[model samples]
Target: MAGRRTERIDEWRERVDELCYDGERVEHRLDLECATVVVTTQRVLAFVPTTAGPAFRHVDRPNVGTVTLETSQRLAVLCAGIIAAFAGVATLEMATSITVSSAVPSVDLEGIAPLPGSNLLVGFVETVLAAIETGLLLLQWSVLLAGVAALVAAIGLITYYIRSRTRLLVVRVSGDDDLVVPVSGVDLEDELVVDLEAAIRPAPESTPALEAEDGRRTSSRNWTEIDHEESG
Candidate 1:
């Protein structure tokens, strides 16, 4: 049983090497005690390839990596809030100005129109009301434009948050979701495999293994063990 287990481990290691060199996504099934690796252009999700056909729910999910949901949420919320707040402020200012202008007194100009030298203040109220109307129309148009811009920005934020928060992931043997791995670091042709290999490799330990041997060569070597090892 031990030898069989060792053989299986060796086979898995070899497969891992192949996966590393080929730059393919590999699903290591700890539950089933074997691994299934496949190469496909489509991003991996729940299904994995098999000789018979694609296997659904055959492998255990990997939990190796972390997702950055907070950053995306923060950025989208910040952008949307700024746009909405600016639009609200502009709308409030326009409303206040319109209200203040409409409250002013309107002096009648038709009563004093007979005199020839009364032209200066003759239509002051009408002119003021006309100017206020024109200003209100312009302000309404500006508010409409700002509202539309804010709505579009809010929609963009919603879209971004939805995409960033949720994903269809396929867990690899290394306990990582292979689908969401960033491919920006590598060329398109080699990115898939390179990222898979990077995910599977174990972190370096405090003790270093010997160059030619499987055992660790400690910094302080025992002279007696060296002499006995030489004799043996």
Candidate 2:
């Protein structure tokens, strides 16, 4: 029989371990690029890994006060601005430097020197290459500009994908400071939010004798919700 390999716990996991109590265990975890949001049996943990060490914060499940969202489009706007400037400069320079050339020189024989036994003079112009036509030059720059536009569009898409996704969750506790955790991807975000709500908000206790149509709403775990709350 082959033995199973155990998962290694690094420094970051150690930090996560220290955030929990002796009996508290992690229930749901959403791992992001630099941060992780964990829903534990008794708490919610926000862990950020850095060069020096792991920075971690947590709040008791019942003490959670407000959960807000912070969204930003600054990076996307900055990228668009910088690339627009670059494209303007590049197009202007090309327009100024790409003028039509009409200095083509043609060679004409003044006098003929005869060969040894023949009255014919064999002429060979060393450099007789014709310059590119004006229309063709313009067309070339047009193609180059198209290529540049394609490149800029590609960069814009890439920046939108990477730098523009700065959505985060700001969890505020009753007396503690807010814990900020970066979130990405729809699956992770949905699952984490669901687990967090389940952990904090209690489910109604029901027996077989209680019918749903005849029961009134219980207020055991009732909490007020502040919608559309923005955080920085």
Candidate 3:
């Protein structure tokens, strides 16, 4: 009876080994809780403190990555303010120069004191118009810059959202365990799936025989060879 039980155990071990040797195993699961996103991976479980819940856990698969979101309004307003300030300073400088030049009595208006007053008033009004034009130009530039910044930020946020919530899957043949690798860099999220698939490729036909030969060589190297010819 004991022999039978031993045989059964051996058979069971062999079955498990065979299943692992010829199995397709790929899986991923992801979840979320409040501010923290829980990413779980199959077979590659990480041990955490019991206080955090279960001691063993894995990252979430079949889910997208993480995204940090923020509003660009502050940056936009800052840019608009800077543009407006620069335009204000430039307009003030140009207006001052215009006022000074207007005060220099031109020969055309030298004899007519009242006409000079009218001309001076006209120059003052023109300066105000020029200042207004500067303000308008600054406003237009600010709007354009703000629009471009918002567009860029929106596109970035959208891309982040899509990638974060994307479903990632893995497929493997056998082994009760799966490995989930955190991928980074350009276009690596999708590439991770390909890499996982490649990891399960069957070993070459001669690999096992070669491994056996290597084992023999290693054993031989560990001990001196006994030869009758050397003894003679």
Candidate 4:
């Protein structure tokens, strides 16, 4: 099973690599259950695996105007609904058990003495009532336990969902279009943003070099003009 999963991941990675430019190399790769994301020197590529085939989205670093991250609440909401349903069922079971137990008549076992056949009859009634009460108590407890289990599960689910849920990375493109990518980890998002910024922003040192070259060219032009005047 593990081998097969690894093979599938390799296939997805290959698909992502295919979408990159000729010389672009992947700097970071994040593999999600439903999708795979790769950050390259030139662009960010997201590949979603589906029943039909793999779907892909590419966001060029230079075209990304802004990136925004937001948390998703779908899993948390679903877990909350499950917890509420379990609690409701437990409450109903407890109320039903209480009403049923109260409706049954109680026997005065202590007040009755050894009255031959009458004692046997009273003993049987007491035994039957005890069994019924025991069953009701067991039923109530089972329901309560189920509710508690559901509550624990819901709490764990909420905690995990809050911590590990995919973050929405909205990339606003140059033409006002948006490219939404579901990123899993905070570190991955930070790296992606850093790469994007690096790609978009020009290097500060390049400006100084260009200015110096232009100054040298202007000086040479003046020197040439002075030589031409002397020759004339």
Best by lDDT: 4
Candidate 3's displacement at residue 139, Å, is 0.4
Full-model lDDT for every candidate: 0.46, 0.59, 0.41, 0.67
Q: Which stretches of candidate 1 lie over 4 Å from their true place?
A: 1-27, 30-105, 123-125, 166-232
| Candidate 3 or 1, higher lDDT | 1
Compose the digit string of candidate 3's lDDT tens values, residues 97-204. Answer: 443334434333344546747778667766776676667566556655655555555555545544554322322213333322222343235444444333233335
- Summarize candidate 4's per-residue lDDT along 1-232 as a digit string, tens digits: 6466556755866776666679987776766555666768777676654323335667777776765676656765666757766775666566555655775677777655766577788878888998888887787777677766666766666676666665666657886456665665544545666654454444467687899999999999999999999999
Model 3 scores what on Cα lDDT?
0.41
Estimate, for each residue in 1-232, the C-alpha lDDT of model 1 and write its tens digit.
Answer: 6565546545654554333335445443222122233322222222222213323322222333432211123565657756775775676566545653555456777778887766866666578777877777777677766766776676676676655652212334344323322222122343434554444444345444444343334423566688789999
TM-score of each: 0.36, 0.41, 0.29, 0.47
User: Residue 226 error for model 3, in Å?
Assistant: 76
Task: State candidate 1's TM-score.
Answer: 0.36
Task: Indicate the worst ten consecutive residues by lDDT in candidate 1.
Answer: 42-51
* Prediction-by-prediction clash tally: 5, 0, 21, 0
lDDT of 4 at 149: 68
**Residue 98 in candidate 2, Cα distance off native in Å:** 13
lDDT pick, better of 3 and 4: 4
